[model samples]
Structures are given as structure tokens and as C-alpha cells.
Target chain A: MNFKMRQLFAVARHEFLNQFNSFSYWMMFVIPLIVVTALFKYVNLKFNFNNSNFINMVWGFSIPVLTFFFCLIYIGIIANSVARDKTSKLSEMLMSIVDAKEQINGKMLGIYLLLCFQIAFYTIFILILSKVMNNNFLFLFIGRVKIGLIVYSILALFVSLFMFLAITVQFSCFITDTSQISSATMPPMIFLLEFFSLSLLYNSVGFDGDNMIWIFYIICMWPPVGSTLTPSLIASGNISYLFAYSTLIIQIMIMYILYVKSIHVFKYGLLSNKKKNIFIEGFKFR
Target chain B: MIEFKNVSKSYDGFQAVNNLSFQLHKGEILSLIGQNGAGKSTTFHMLLDFIKPSSGNINRNNNLNIGYMPEERGLYLKESIKNQMLYFASLHGMKRVEALKKIKVWMEKLNVVGDIEDKVESLSKGNAQKVQLIACLMFNPDLLILDEPFSGLDPVNADLLIKAVLEAKKSGTMIIFSTHNMENVEKLSDYVVMLSHGKTVLKGTLNDIYNQFGRSKLDIVGYNNLQKFEGMNGIKNIDIINDNSAHITLNDVSFGKYIFDDVTKEGYLPVFNQHYPTLDEIFKTKVKQSE
Candidate 1:
């Protein structure tokens, strides 16, 4: 491998191993399995239901809820890792080797792989639980989870992660202490969560298909906002698969640009120890 | 070779390094001495490109690979000493195997005894410092900039560090460091730069600096009644401890023979040694003059 690639791999490996070494990794993976299993068992013991609509509701709501929970927990891990490095002043050492862009890319890749691993494990757990409970495996895996929805969900999840990463990177630049990173990161995240809830609520109320399509398009194209909203649009069948994919491609391109900008901010923030308004520092490029 | 020309760094309106310029030859060890906040750390930061100069230029002739040990030593407390050393070496462009080998050699040279797998936090302060110093030198960079490398070290460890620095200099590494200890500078520095209030007040070889200050002393122990030369016209200052012994600083070199004659007349003189000014004396005079 070349120098940049080698350095990138080293960073990614360090990040991955550090997370794996933590107690929280196992907790995140196993807690979801237990919760899903317990809920399935409780529902089976409490009622004998031949009602497909009830099952459909549970399935639809559960996937989004579970996905959101997993994503939230994982976001904390990624944010804390970034924050810890900044707080401990290790970011300066990393910057000495590669520029900001490579560092972010490597970190993002590590978190992405970690999320994929969690998602894969949860999917397998659900599949096995269905077989044991004699529920329809096809409905669990394929029927409720359309290929289009799955593709869009993955895309949306990545977009959201990149957006969070960007915001954290920018905030981390202005913060000298790790204690401030959580407060610094909360604003963008709260905005993203609000947008996510609104989109889900609109989908539940059954908005006009065309109006929903327009909303999804706008969200997918938005610079930092697109990360959370794009996938919900895809899952709700508001946008066609082709249109969602195309918009996602454009969103990724925009995220790349924003990623570069945020890395520049992060580079400066890591070295600065003085107190300043994070928002002001993020915009004042030097 | 390295050069910083008219470099000025400012944060807000306050200047950290104000119009600073200096040069380092290939093999000389330059000691940068200053009071706290006198801009020595800022100069080191500019040398490594950690912070940009507001206006001016710092030029390096080649691809400058620098090994920096910051005033606050950068090492993961939880990481094993071997692991941390290897990680740093790899970052400096060494392969893992080579880095490991170099770590072993350095650990042994420093007489560090412990399992290589022990965490850095488990090591004593002096041992941890040795590990940090080893990490800096493991890569054998062309330029080594150490900021207060001996701050928390005891005398023995400090001497060990001085020896290591001397060896690096012999192998042709341009070493620049900042320290508050003037004795270390006297022992190890070939050239010195004394800064006061963000300005270079004194810069030259150690011998040249002391020569320019022109205050010499003679210690006489056996002379009885040395009060005859106490207020001589040739003497700029005279300090007498008891009647037989005195230290005199001369205004002229010609007075050395005159003092010798006067001492000889006092009685059989047992000890009369001329003393050149030390770096400590020169530093005190220079800083006082700046004020």
C-alpha cells in the first residue's frame, strides 16, 4: 500500500480495535438481541393472533425503532472516540502524519464497518428468533424489508453518520476539553433527531405521495440535514428506487465537500486550547 | 540546516513570536534559554509547522523529519511502553519490526528493566521519561526538537539524557532544546541563544559569549593579607572572604600578572587560579542588561 493508504489503515485499525476492546461493544450487540427476543416471546405468550396487520405494524415500527436505537448508541461511541482523542491531545500526533481529510475518512470508515457489523448481527438474531417462534421468515426478512427500502435505509444511515461526523469534527475544533464535546455535538444532533421524527410522523399520517417525494428529494440534497431524512423517504416508498439512488449519490458528493471543510476546522480546533465560541470558530476558516 | 527568518506569530493582537530569526547548523546543539512566556515554545512550534507564523518564513533545506518531545510528554498512559514506542516510530515512517528492534536497543541502553508489555503508567516518572526520550530518538530524525526534556528527571536521569543528546550530536543530528537549567547548557551547548521578553539578547558560541562579557576571577587561598589589592584601580570588583582569600574581577587582562605579583609578595601562594566567566554569569548579566 502507498503511504496515505497505509496511514489510513493504521488509524482505522486503531479506532476499530479500541472500540472492540470496550465493554460497550458487547452490550450494544447483545442488548438488542435480548430485547427483540423478549418482546417476540412476550407477544406470542400473551396472544394468539392470526392478524397480519398487527404483525405488519409491529414489524414496520420495530425495525425503525431498533435501527434508531442502535444508530443512537453507536453515534455516542463514535463521538466519544473522536472527543477522547481530541481531549487527550492525540489528534495532534495523528495530524502530524496525514492531513485532516484522510483522518476523517479513516475514522468514518471504521465507524461504518462497526455499524454494519451490529446491523448484520441483529438481522441474524431476528431471523433465528422467527424460526424458533414459527413466524414467517420471509415476512421478517424480505416482505417487510423491501430491497428498495433496505438500500435507501443503508444510504440514509451513512448520510446521517457522515453528517454527525462532520458536525462533531467541527465542534471538536472549538473545544479544548472533552467535557465540552458532548454539549458542542448536541445541537446538530437534536436538529437531526427532530427532522427524523417529523419525517416518520408525516409518513404515519399518510401524506400525499408526490408531496412526500418532494420532501425526500430536498432532504437528500441538503448538505448536513440530508443524512437523516433521506433514508426515511426511501423506506416510506415516497421516492422511487432510481430517484432515491441518484439523490443519494449527489448527497454523498456534497458530504465529501463538507467533510473536507469540517476536517480543516477540526485540524485547527485540535491544536487550539483557548476558549472561543464553537460556532464562530467553525465559520472562521484560516 | 534550518532557518527562521523574521518570523512573527500573533494570536488576536498579542505576538507570541515577534520577528524571530535563527539558524541551526548540521551537527551543533543549540540551547534556547529564556524565562517563561519568553516565546521559546512558540519558536519550537513554528519549527515543526504545528502553528503557522503570522508573517515571515521558516525554511528547511530538505524533507525535514522532526522528532518532537513536547513539554507535556505525549504518550498514551494506558498503552504498553513497547506498543507506544513502536506506534510513534511507525508514525515517523519505520516498519514495525525495525521499530521494535530499535525500542529494545534503546530500552537496554537506558537501563530500563521491565517487561516490554508493561503499561507506561506502571513505569516510574524517570523511567517514563526515558521511554519518551527513546521514542524521540528511535526514528533518528534529521532534526530533533525537545522542549524541556529534563523537567521532571532527577540528576542521574538528566545526566543520562545529556549523554544521549551528545551522542546524537556526534552522529550529525541538529538538536535544539529549551531548558531553565543553566548548568546543562554549560555542559552540552556548543552555541546558545538567550531570549528575554521575546527578543534575542545574546547569541554566539559559549566561549565567544563569556569572552565578550569580559569579567574574569582569580581564587587565592594561601595568600595572607590579600587586602592590598582590595581597592586597586585595575579591579572592577573585589569580593574578600576572610583575610587570606579573595575573588577579584579585573577591568583589564594586564591586571592578571599584577595580581599574581601582589599575591606572591603576600607569602608563599598555594593556590591562584584564573576563572573564566561561566554561562550562568553571562546569562544573569545579559538578562539584567536587557531589563
Candidate 2:
């Protein structure tokens, strides 16, 4: 690999290890597994329900909720990590060795690797739980989940994660101190909470295709916001598979555009010491 | 070689560095001396490409390996010294084993009074600074930029840092450091750039800078004829410490020779020395003149 790529991965590995080695990160990783396992044990003992229908419903509800929780936890991680580099003043030294683009990308890549690990770890735990509990959760989940909705949700989930991560990183660049991190992360947090609310709302009250609300379609087609909504809408049978996939494509395109803009802000925000309005200054070309 | 050709940096209406020009060859140590906000850090920042000059050119190899220490010291306070050093080494593409070896050697050489596994927050202020220096030096960078490296260092620790820097210099690293400490500059620099309010007020070797000011200071002891110097034409000011000793400032360097005869006529003068102004004095004079 070339020097830039080497530096990028070095940073990524450093960031990943830094978080991975921390006690709190491991706590965050392990606690959820323990809680879910305990909850599963409780449900099995109380209801004695291990049927495929219950498993399918559990997954349908759990996917979006789990995603929301992942975004919530990792957003703080990404923002704090970025702000820590700046507040500690190590960003200047790193700037000499690696480009700002590399630093930002490396950090995001590092967090994504951790997210992957979390996902892999949870998947393994679920598989093991399924076997031990005598419930074929994966088989049932696969047999029942609509393939189109599955593809759309998988695609939307990843795209939404990247979009939220990109937005968090961009805002976190404006943070000069630990005190400013909460305020800097406010915008992305609001968006994430809104996306979560929309997902749960649509999942409960299915969209009506006959008496269509144009606004719901807009929400379902826009990126990040649309990421969960489109999959939920598709599952509700209010949107066609073609429309759902097309909206996924459109969300990807919007994400790319936002990625380009966020990268620009990422470069400027890392080095900026002045506490300017991110909404105004973030879009300004330096 | 790194060369700055008529470089200038301006922010909005303020000129942070104004038409600066200098060149640094391999194995050379150039000291940039200035007061706070005197553009020393700005010059370093431009060289490191942290900021760009608004005008002129800085010519250097695009791929030159550089190590930079900013004015504000920084380290991961919660990280082990070894971990952070390895992370920095990895950034420069240094092999892990080789970097570990260098870290051990540098820490010992700099007298860092802490274990490699010690978190940086556990180190004393001076030791932490040394660790920061080690991170810069261990990779053997081609161009090393240090800003105010001696600011808070005690004399002994400063001497240790000086020795380490000199070693780097002997190995042919082109070093550029900024400092408010004139003594360290005088001891370490092969070339000096003195700035005042973003303008280059003096630029040359220590000897050259001294020569420009001329040998206008005279020290004398056990001289009997203090009265003979009272009406001297070249005397700018004189303070007679006693009947046998005095310090004199000359209006012209040629006047040193003129006073030599009278001081030695006493037959056994213990001290008679005429010398150029000290770097500290020169620094004061130049800064005063610029202001």
C-alpha cells in the first residue's frame, strides 16, 4: 500500500485499539449482550414461547431499535474521540504526519470496525442463544422476513449508519474542548432521535397506500430518514419492492453528496479553534 | 535543503509573517528568536504546511520527512508513553520492533524518569516534555521543527534536551527551532533569524550578528588610570566599580584599541578584555530598535 493508505490504516488501527482496550468500551459491548440474554431467558421461562412467528416479530422490532441504540452509543464515541484529539492538542501533531482527510476517514473507519465487531459478536450470541433455547431464530427469521424488505433494510441500515456517523464527525470537528462536545453533537443527535421516532411510528401505524400521505413518501425516500422508514413502509405493504429499492438507491446518492460536503467540513473543523456556528460556518468553503 | 524564498503570510489584514526568506541545509541548526506573537510560530506553521503563506514561495522536497513540535505541548495524557510513541512511530512507517528499541534508547538518553508503560499524566512536567521530544526524535526525521522547546525546562533538563538536539544535528537533521531563550539559541544555532512583530530584524550566524553590532563592550580590572578614560571620545557610558575596575561601552569599536594602551600601562592589569555584545544584549538592542 501507498504511504497515505498506510498512515490512514495506522490511525484507524490506533483508534480502534484505543477504544477496544478501554474498560468502558468493553462494558458497553458486554452489558447489552448480558441484558438481552437475561431478557430472553425471562421471556422463555414466563411464556414458554419459542415459535417462529414470535421470533419474526421480535426481529422486525429489534432491528430498528438495535440500530437506534448503536447509533446513539457510537455517536458519542465518535464525537468524543474527535473532540479528545483536538482538546488534547494531538491533532496538530497528527496533521503533520497525516492529511486531515486521512485523520477523519481513519477515525470513521476505526469506529466502523468496532461497530462491525459489535454486530458480529451479537450475531454469534444470538445464534448460540437460538440453539441453547431450542428456538431456530435465524431459520424462522429468514423464512418469514420478506426478501425485498430484508435487502432494503440491510442496505438502508448501513447507509443510515454511515450518514449519521459522517454527520457526527462533521459536527464534532467544531468541538475544541470536552465541554463543547454535547453542543457540537446536538444536531446529529436530534436527527438520529427523529429517525428512531419515525421508524417506531411507521412500524406501528402502517402507511396507507390508497390514502397516501405524500409527506410519508418523501420521508421514506430521503436518505437517513428514509433508511428505516422505507424498509418499514415496504414491510407494511404500502410501497412496492421496486419503489423501496429505488428509494434505497436515491438515499445512497444523497448520502454520497452529503459525504462530500461533510468531508469538506471535517477538514476545516479539525483544525478550527474558533467556536463558530457550524450550521453557518460548516458549509463555508475555506 | 529547505528554503523559504520571500515567504509571507497574512490573515485578513494582519501580516503574521512578512516577506521572510531563509535557507536551511542538512546538519544545520537555525534558531528563530522572537517574542510571543512575533511570527516565530507562524513561520514554523507555514513550513509544516499547517498554514499557507499568502505570498511568495517555500521550496522543499514534497516528500521530505518532517517532525514538528508545536508551541503548545500535546500528548495523550491517559495513554502509556510507549503506546503513544509506537502510535507516532507507526505514522512515520517505522517498524514496531525498531521503534521500540529507539524509544528505550531515547528515553534513557533524555533521562526521562518514568517507565515506558507509565501514563504521560504520571510524568513530571519536565519529563513529559522530554517524552514529547523523544516522540519527535525517535523516527529520525529529515526536517525537525521545534517551537519554544526550552520554555519551562530547568537548566539541567534543558541541557539534556540540548545534548539530544545536538546529537540530532550531528546526524545531519536540518533543525529549525523557535525560542525566547537567547542562551540556548547562542549555544545551539549555526544560523539565527530574530523577528519582531512579524518582521525579520536580524538574520545571520551568531558571529555575524555580533559583528554587525561591533565589539563595543570593554571590561577592565586593576587599571590605575580611570581618570584617563573620563574624556575619551568613543566612550558612550562607563561605570567605575572601584578605583581598579570599570565597565565601559564604546561609541566605536576602533576605540577599544585606543583605550588598550592606558589600561596596560599600569604594568600588571589583571583583566583587560574588549568583546562584542552578548547575544542577550544584542537581542535586547535589536528588539528595542524594532519596537
Candidate 3:
């Protein structure tokens, strides 16, 4: 790697280790895994899941709840991770050594690596637990969900994470004080919650009507929200694989553009002390 | 070497730094002394490329290795001092083993009074500041900028820090530091730039600064007839501190010899001193002049 890449990785590694060693980061990572696992275990014990309905119920409930739980954890983690540097006044020192874009990218990469670890750890634990308990429902659920849909769902999850993390980092750069983090990151959290609510609504009520399907199509095109809704739409057979793929492409493009634009805000916001509108500051590319 | 040619920075309509120019060469320590908001931090920021000058040119190698300590001191409160220093050293491209060795040396050299494994929060305020300095110093940066490095440090710890800075200077690291303390500036600076309200009011060596004001202050003790100098030609003002002692201000340096001769006519006096103004006095006089 080149010098710039080395510096970027140094930042990423530092951030990762710092967060990895923190008590709160572990709370955010481990608690949700335990809570969701217990909830799943309860479902396993309470309901007789010998049919496709049970599979649908379990998968549907798990996706949104898991997403919401992890979202809450990630929101806190990312906010603190970004704000800690600025509030502690470490950002100014780091800024002298590392470029703003490098710092943002490094921080995101570090947290994202941790998120990947969480996902992998959670998946492995769930797999082992299901096998150990001889819970056929998990296998049944996996068998029933088409491979393509499973792939699309994972893709959509990652896309949404990337997009939302960019938004959070952008807003987080504006935080000069730790008290301002929740408020600084509120816009992205609001976006996530709104779509999270929609995911729940569509999953439970079933948007089977033509108009609602069109709305799902529209939601699937909008970045962030689209990333969350695309998988469910595909799983319901409301949208084809091609449309899902197109929306995925659209989401990636939007994420890329948004990330590039956020680089500017990231550069300026990290140094600014004033509280400014995220939209105004984030969109002002210079 | 780094050179700032006619640098000026303004925010909205308020100038933060105005028409500042200076040069720093290898092994030279330049001290920036100014009151709060005197643009000392702004000068450092411009050198670090954190901010751009609205007008002027700063010429230097773009990739010069630099270590900077901001005025508002900070460290990762939750991490061990060792961990944070190693992380920063790695950012500066130092190997882990090298950084560790350097950390041990710096901690001992600075009398940090804590274990390397101690979290920054566990250390006292002064020790934490020492850790911050260690982070900047361990990398052996080509150019080191310390803003208010002396602030919050006790006299003993300040001396330890001073020794460490002088060591860096001896190793040929070009250094610039800003402080309100004129004593440290006099001790460490090869050259000094004093700023007043974003303007360069005094810029030169300590001797040059003192020479500009001349030997205008005289202190005499155990001398009688202090009233003889009152309203005397070439005497600007006189303050009789005690029956036999007085503080005299001269209109010209040449008058020192005249006073010395007059006071010693009878015999040797216990105290009759003639000298240039102190850095503190020069600083005050310059601030007042700019205001």
C-alpha cells in the first residue's frame, strides 16, 4: 500500500481497537445478540413451527426486530465514536496528521469491520445454537427462503448500512460537544426509524394492493429506505429480481454520491464549532 | 526550512492573523508570545494546513513530518497512555517496538509519575498533559509546534518539559511554540515573534527586543539620597521603594553611567544595577503600544 493508504489504515485500526476495547461498544454488540437470541428461543419454544406460516412469521419478525435492535446499538456506537474525537479535542491533532476524507473513511471502515464481526459472530452463534438444540425451524426457514432472496436481503442490509453510516458520519462531524451527538445524528436516526417502521408495516400488513406495490417500488428506488424495503418486496414476489437488482444498483450509486459529498462536510464539520443545519452544511460541497 | 510570506487570515470581516511573515530553519526554536486571541494559534493552524491564509504564500515541503499540540489539551481519556501513544506513533509511521521504547523513555524523562498502562483519566492533570506531549514527541517529527505547552504545568514539571524540548531542538528539530509565559520564551527561543491582536508587534531575537527598548530600567539598593534623581535630566521617572532604595526609569541608556558615577562618588554602594528591560517588560510595553 501507499503512504496515504497506510495512514488511513492506521486510523481505521486505531478506531477499531479503541471501540473494540470499550465497555459500551461491547454492550451494544453483545446485548442485542443475547436479547434477539432469547426472543428467538422463546419463539422456538412457544410456537409449533412445523409449517411455512411459522417460518414466515419467524423470519418476518426477526428481520425487522433485529434490524431495529442493531440500528439502535449502531446509532449510539457511531455517534460516540465520531463525537469522542471532536469533543475530546483529538480531532484537531489527528487532522494535522490525517486528511479529513481519510479520517472519515478510516473511522467508517473501522466501525464497519466491527459490524461485520458482529454479524458473523451472531450468525455463527445462531447456527450453532439451532444445531445444538435440534431446532428444525431455522433449517426449515432457511430451506424455504429462496437462495436469490437471501442473497438480495443480505445485499440490501449491507447497502443500507453503508448509506446510513455515511449519513451518520456526516452529521457526526458537526458535533463539537458530546451532548450534541444525539441531536447531530438525529436526522439519520430519524430516517432509519421511519423506514424501519415502514418495513414492519409492510411485513405484517402485506402490501398486496397494486397501489401499495407501486409505493413499494417507489420506496425501493429511494436510497436508504429503498435499501431496507427492497428485500421484503422481493421476498413477497411484489418485485422481480431484475427490479431488485436495478434498485440495488441505484442505492449503491446514491450511496457513493452521498459519501463523496459527505467528504466535504466531514472535512469542514470536524473543525467547525457552530451548530448548523445538516442538510445545508452537508450539501454544500466545496 | 519553512517560510511564511505575508500571510493573512480573516473570518468574515474580523482578521484572525494579519500580514504575518517569518522563517524557521533546522535546529532553530521560534517562540510566539501573545495574549489570548493574539493569533498565535492561528499561525500554528496555518502552518499545519488546518486553515488556509486568505492572502499570502507559505513555502515548505508539503510532506514535512510535523507534531502539533493544541492549546486545549486532550487525550483519549479511556485508553491507557501507552496504547494512545503507540497508536499516534504508528500514524507517524513508527514501528510498534520503537514507539514502545520511546514511550518508556519519554515517560521517565518527563517525570510523568504514572505507569504506562495507566489510563489518561487515572493520571493527574499535569501528567495527562505530559502524556499528550509524549504523543507529539515520540515520533521525532521534523517540525514540532506546541501551543501553550507551558500552560497548567507546575514549575518542576515545566522544567522537565523544557529539558525535553531542548533535547528535541538539539536533535535539529525546528520548533515553534506559543505561550503567554515570557520567561520560557526567553529561555527557549532563538527568535521571538510577539503578536498583539493579530498583528506582529515584536519580531526578533530576545536581545534584539531588549535592545529596541534600551537599558531603561535601573534598580539601586542600599543607596542614600534617592531624592537626588527626582526631576533630574535624563530620568523619566523614579520610584523610591524604601528609604535607601529606588526604581529608576531612564530617558536614555547613556544616563546609566551618569547615575552610576553620581551614586558611587563617595564610595561603593551595595547595589547599583543597569540593564536592559526584561522580556516581560518588553512584552507589556509592546502590548500597550499596540493597544
- Per-candidate Cα RMSD to the true structure, in Å, reads 3.6, 2.9, 2.9
lDDT of 2 by residue, A1-286 (tens): 9998998899899889989998888888888899868766766443224564454345556667877888877888888888888888877777888888788778878988998889898888988987897766355556666665566677777887888888888888888778878876788788888878876676666666667756665666677887866666666556777777777787888888888888777766776777777555644555
TM-score of each: 0.87, 0.92, 0.92
Best by DockQ: 2
Query: What are the per-residue Cα lDDT tens digits for candidate 2 across B107-151?
Result: 999999999999988999999999989989999999999988997
Clashing pairs in 2: none
lDDT score for residue B67 of model 2: 86
- Which lDDT value does model 3 have at B252? 84
Please state the error at residue B214 of candidate 2 in Å.
1.4
Clashing pairs in 3: none
Worst 10 residues of 2 chain A by lDDT: A44-53
For the predicted complex of model 1, DockQ is 0.36
Considering the two chains of model 3, state its CAPRI-style docking category. Answer: medium
lDDT of 2: 0.83
TM-score of 1: 0.87
Instruction: List DockQ for all candidates.
Output: 0.36, 0.76, 0.69
Predict model 1's lDDT versus the native: 0.73
Alpha carbon deviation, residue A67, candidate 1 (Å): 5.7
